[model samples]
Target: MAVELALSADTVRMIVQKARAVSESLPDTYEDGHEGDLSFDTEKLENVHHHDGLAEEEHDDFSESELREIIDDLNVDEATELVAIAWIGRGDYDQGDLDLAFAEARERSTSPVSTYLLGLPLLPDYLEAGLEALNL
Candidate 1:
C-alpha cells in the first residue's frame, strides 16, 4: 500500500524548532496552565519507520524504531527533530553522522532545513549546513 506523507522539509524544521521552543518556554506544562498530559509512545515510532524507509532495511534497528515512534507520537510537528534527539540520547550517531545525513538530505531535496533539523546535533555542523542549504 502507498502511504501519503504530508509534511514538507521546511515545515518539519519549523515544527522541530517550534517544538523545542515550546518545551523550553514551558518546561513544566503541568506546573504551568497547560491543561493536558504529554507523553511519548513507541507505536508512533513504528509508524515513522514504516513511512520513513526503515521498513525496507534488512537489519532491524528496534531502538531507532522506538525512538521514531516516540517522536512520531508527539503532539508537535517537529517529530523528526525529536527523533534525532532521541537518537543522540541512544548514542546511535555522532555530530559527523548528523552532518553527513544533512548534506545527503540537502542533495536529495529542496527542504534541507527540515531534514537537517530532524538530524539535529547528531552533528552540530548540521545546523549551519541546514541554514545555509535552506538559505535561512
Candidate 2:
C-alpha cells in the first residue's frame, strides 16, 4: 500500500539527503577527537598559515544547520509524521501501525521535533527504511 503524505516527496528526499550528509560526516568531524588539537604542532601551524580557509572536513555545520532549519520549518502534522516515519523505519512501529505511531510521536514528544530527530544517529537510514516500508 502506498502511504500518502501532506509533506511532499521532494521535501522528504531533500531532508534525507541532508540528513545522510550530516550523519555520514559526523563521526569524522565530531567523534574523531583529533580535529582541533593545538598541543605541540608547530609544523602543522606553519602549513595552516598558508591555507586560505577552514577545511570542510573540520565541521558539518552547514548540513546540520540546514537540516535543523528544514525540520523547524515543517508544520505540526508534518513534523509528527516525520517522527512517526522514523519510528517505523527503526522497527518501533510497522506500516500498518502508522496512525498509532503518529499518536505516540505526538504524545511522547517533550522537546522540539528537530531536536528529537537530530539526536538519532541513524536518522537517515531509519527514514529511508520507513519510506520504503510505506512504499512512498
Candidate 3:
C-alpha cells in the first residue's frame, strides 16, 4: 500500500526506543536449562516457553499490564499503524504491502498491543527496518 503514514518517523522512533528499553528491562521469559549467555532462538524460545503444558510464556520485571496500558493509550490509527510496522518488520508484508498490511493488522488485532508486540524479541529492529522501508 502506497498510502501515507498517519504516524511520523519521530513517533515510530520513539516507539522503537521504548520497546527496546522495555525488552532490556524484562528478564528472560524462556528457560532453556542451559546457563551462561542466553541464545535468543525466537522460535525455540517461544515454543518451549510454556506454563504447565499450555503455551503461556512468563513475564518478568516488565509490567505487561502497564505496557498494555501504554499501547492502549495510542489512538486507533496509531495502534493499527504500529501493528502494520510490526508486520513489515516480520516480513509478513513488504513495504509495498502497506495498505493491505495495515488493514490486516487492524483485522488481526484481537489481542492487546503489549501482548502481541512483547512476544517478539526483535521488535525494535523490526520497527527500525520497517521505518526505513517506508523511508520514514
What are the Cα lDDT values of the candidates?
0.36, 0.68, 0.62
Write candidate 1's Cα lDDT for 1-136 as tens digits. Answer: 2112233344334333444443332323232432232233334333343234432335433343343343354332234433333344345444446544323332333222223233443333333334333333
- Best of the two (1, 3) by lDDT: 3
lDDT of 3 by residue, 1-136 (tens): 2347755566667657667768776555434732122112223323331223111223333355545555555556666787788778778898888889877776665555655676667878988988877777
Q: Taking the tens digit of each residue's C-alpha lDDT, what string does model 2 give over 1-136? A: 8888865555666677778877765544224432221111223222222212222224445577767766766666677778888889999999999999887776775566676777677888898888888898
Q: Which one wins on TM-score?
A: 2
Q: Output the number of the lDDT-best candidate.
A: 2
- Ranking of models by TM-score: 2, 3, 1
Q: What lDDT does model 2 reach?
A: 0.68
Candidate 3 TM-score versus the reference: 0.65
Worst 10 residues of 2 by lDDT: 33-42
Evaluation by TM-score, superior candidate among 1 and 2? 2
What residue runs in model 2 are displaced by over 4 Å at the alpha carbon? 25-62
Model 1: worst 10 consecutive residues (lDDT sum): 29-38
Q: Against the hidden reference, what TM-scores do the models get?
A: 0.22, 0.71, 0.65
